[model samples]
Target: MKDREDILRQIEELQKKFLEILANNPGIVVVNSDQTGQVKETHSTRTLAPEGEKDVVVEIENASATTHAVTVLPTIYLDGRQHPKVYVHLGEATGALPKFKPVYSNPNLVIGASKSHIMNKEGTERFLKEVLFIQPMPKHMLLLIDSWPLFLNHSFIQQFVPQGHKVTILNIPKGGTSLSQPLDLNYNQQWKSVMRRLNDAILIHEIDYKIHVRDNLLRAISQVYWCFGAPRFCEFRRYGWYKGGYLDTHPAPFVTPPKYLFGEGSEGDCTCGEPGLILCPYCEKPHCFICFVANSHRCA
Candidate 1:
């Protein structure tokens, strides 16, 4: 028993060291958004969390049965409580959308694919195309995938063409899938060939890592891995985020550092109901939710 316990302790220490090494490696990051609008981050080697009490909020309003539509707004709590003030002007909600937010306190690092985002055959194909089309790729690229066809398809297997610094993908999946052609086989055979084509592509992975596909896969990739996986995602997601707006960029003002850091500064309420130092300073303003537009005139 004593010997076994010692061995277990040594193994634990070794695992920690391994994780540290992988986290520092330059590779890819994966980003995932589920029905709950919770964001998950993944990286090629490990996972990490956004540091703070921040909780991503997604609001849905005007929901009806027949008229179904979904809008996602990522946000964090103003105070320590569970109140997520982020608003989404969704039309209706019938089907379930698994929106996931990261637990910024203890985030997973960007590693391989998270199973949450991996969909059926068609979904996998669409995701692969998105990865291929992203322009101005980052220094290191990471892909989080689960489907065998999408992972091994010719479109992706063409070769590693590094337009930027680095590129990699985290292939995620459940244990008992009916995939005859495992992605690992294709990757092992073609990875070297692809690397040669890119000239500067770097691949990062740990052989013994057991990644959870359903829960942490998308979360790990989206929040952390996306940075390395798709550095140009800011340009790509905007196309989807701003479909309702003109000018190509998103019409909505993305949450900045100031917004997240400047929570309730005072004991009393500013127009938004949360206590903060920077009051709306406007009498007509109803709440702090719209204070961005309203208080900007009076305060700023």
Candidate 2:
């Protein structure tokens, strides 16, 4: 657990080293990898207790995440250029993944399961194999990761990340992940927020399905992540790198989900005056409610 000063000093030295490496090889793909956990969320929508009766739903106080809840682990990476892909692992020793996953439209996502909703060695391998390995060979590769035990397995990494062609692994010091890791600085939170909003919004709209159910849960997960292909997500990826102190210039003039969905300030509106416009899947243009939803836009 490095102190703030130590972390800053280490980041400075690391930035210097990274710049030197880039100065020599500009085509190197720097990857920041990490996993995050999300609980199979039950409705947090509050309801009042009837007279002489207990509340219909009550949340446990400080419930244990590891032992109690059924969680899902989504492993992702941002290469500071493209939109990140997702690898979701079902936890609680549930059976295999959903019989039919909805993420087929995007062949990049890989969904799996583990006893603990945590990224085990196998999960790590699958994540790389499914998400990272298939990428076109770059001039060189730099894997920036947290000091997770499995990530320390040089042997396992060599299985796919080719050792000789300048395969460099830089670990973010333990307990310093949020302070120094690009994916952790802000991107993960936004991703999860969008994921949650997507699920909750569908449920609220009475989508005629149970979002907490395994298949539907997987569907919602896939649908939310499919939007990762949006070019603006790439901007968020690079902005995260700059925020993590890995890049020299800020990825400014950027608008991530948090800004677009909920305006950071005054927001422009369409004729319908809908501030929350959905971007067209094909054109990336903002769509108003009447035009996109009521009128039945091309890409539903």
Candidate 3:
């Protein structure tokens, strides 16, 4: 086994290499795409009620009867200028995948529900051709990714590298994903949180209409589209290099600083000046778009 000092040295070297790549490529477009699975509506937690009033428990009846999962592949660019793309995986039961809904034309959504919900070779190729390829980006682009088998496929590399789309697999040290992977460190949690809120909204709507939301592929598709199509969702793609200390601004080098490291004062109130432009589903607190972005849309 390696000694503690030796392991630390190796980690430092790995980070140094990563930073070197970033420093060398100033304007390179960094792309990251990841898969997230969402199941049909789940049981809501039981809540307390006032005295003499019984607690009403909302449970998903026959929860296992109509099992469904949505595999979402969200592609984000480092620069906030480019619009993000999100693809939804539909299982085999949903025959003949539908074209993306008209409203979400810019983000370019695709549907594939055959054999598996997870991204496959075909889906990957389609995404490259339809989403990434068509983007009006620079000649040289870097795709930051984890060690996913599909991403490392020989055919995939052969098809893209010659065209100047380079893929770099992050060498994630043990327990280092939060520090190395952009999607893990910055995007996925925010995406999932938005997904949860969307799911909850759908469930509540179903309850109001006395409709069963389970096994409803259309509902699932709607939720996926709404969440992914949201402008805030696309804006959530922050680069990990800046957050992980692999890249830094002026007056800082080598040393990684804590969040809000510079003596920047606390964030001021939302620019909108409207405290309750939108009400949070969980907390029932009103928040403007600025507040939502600053707080990651979580209940305070």
Candidate 4:
């Protein structure tokens, strides 16, 4: 493991290199985007548990586990322009559908639902076309992102590059997202904090009226979009390649253990955990071959 000082030095070096690249490429701009998942689980600042209990459990009535995937695009151009967009894509779980029709009519705030509660290829393509591509912009745009397959899709890139717009995809260094990616630096926490407050407000309103409906989720999400307009979204774009302060800050350490550990000469072990090793792309942790095969090679 690298020491704190070493990590900080690396971050500074990377930040300088990123800025130099931007300076060399005058027309290119950086737009950082990422997605986060939110469930129907209720979170409150006030606890109802007894004084001695360490855990506070609040029973929610008429509420199922409905997941919603929110994709936030905090665009920060090299020229320091501030126009960000937020997309709330809900999943198609029972009672998870949006009750309010036309959740958001504005182009900046897009709210919709999907069957898997995650952004599919079609949804990603639509976002790039409708929200990103349609916006008035220069000829060259560089989108800095993590290694999400949705962004690296060949067909999507091929389709978008030919429309008089030059789109360049810059994948952040593996395991270096915390230092390189603008959205992960501090914006995601702010967005989630705002969402949690909105959720708590809705929970209180629903309990007061005794109207425990799934629409509460939709209403809360709608209000979040309304509140997190361009100005609020721009606040998240504070950290990026242009900001030298981000490089000076030290990042917190994180480590993930292997999904499955195997003893030497264990039974039913093929290649003794040497061959067919499947690792998580994000964390780079080795997974048990059997578990990976059974679960369709998905990383938890």
lDDT of each: 0.28, 0.59, 0.49, 0.50
**Tens digits of per-residue lDDT for model 4 on 89-142?**
656654244565534243345555567667776677756765566657557777
Off by over 4 Å in 3: 1-14, 46-54, 63-67, 94-107, 160-176, 204-236, 239-241, 247-300
Compose the digit string of candidate 3's lDDT tens values, residues 1-300.
466555556557767776677789777666666666655543344342335787645445574444555676766666533344566665545543544532212234565566656777777777666656565645666665555777655466547544555545444454445566666765566555544443444354342321123224434343333434343333333444456554453222321111111112222333456433334333434444335432345332
Worst 10 residues of 2 by lDDT: 60-69
Provide the TM-score for each candidate, comma-separated.
0.27, 0.72, 0.61, 0.60
**Looking at model 1, which ten-residue stretch has the lowest summed lDDT?**
75-84
| 10 residues in a row with least lDDT, candidate 3 | 254-263
Runs in model 4 deviating more than 4 A are: 2-17, 45-59, 65-84, 93-106, 204-219, 230-236, 240-300
In angstroms, the error of model 1 at 211 is 35
CA displacement after TM-score superposition, residue 296 of candidate 4 (Å): 42
Better of 2 and 3 by TM-score: 2
Tens digit of per-residue lDDT, candidate 2, span 61-137: 33234232233333334444543456777664454544454422234357666666677777778777777655554
Model 3 global lDDT (CA atoms, 0 to 1)? 0.49
Q: Pick the candidate with the highest TM-score.
A: 2
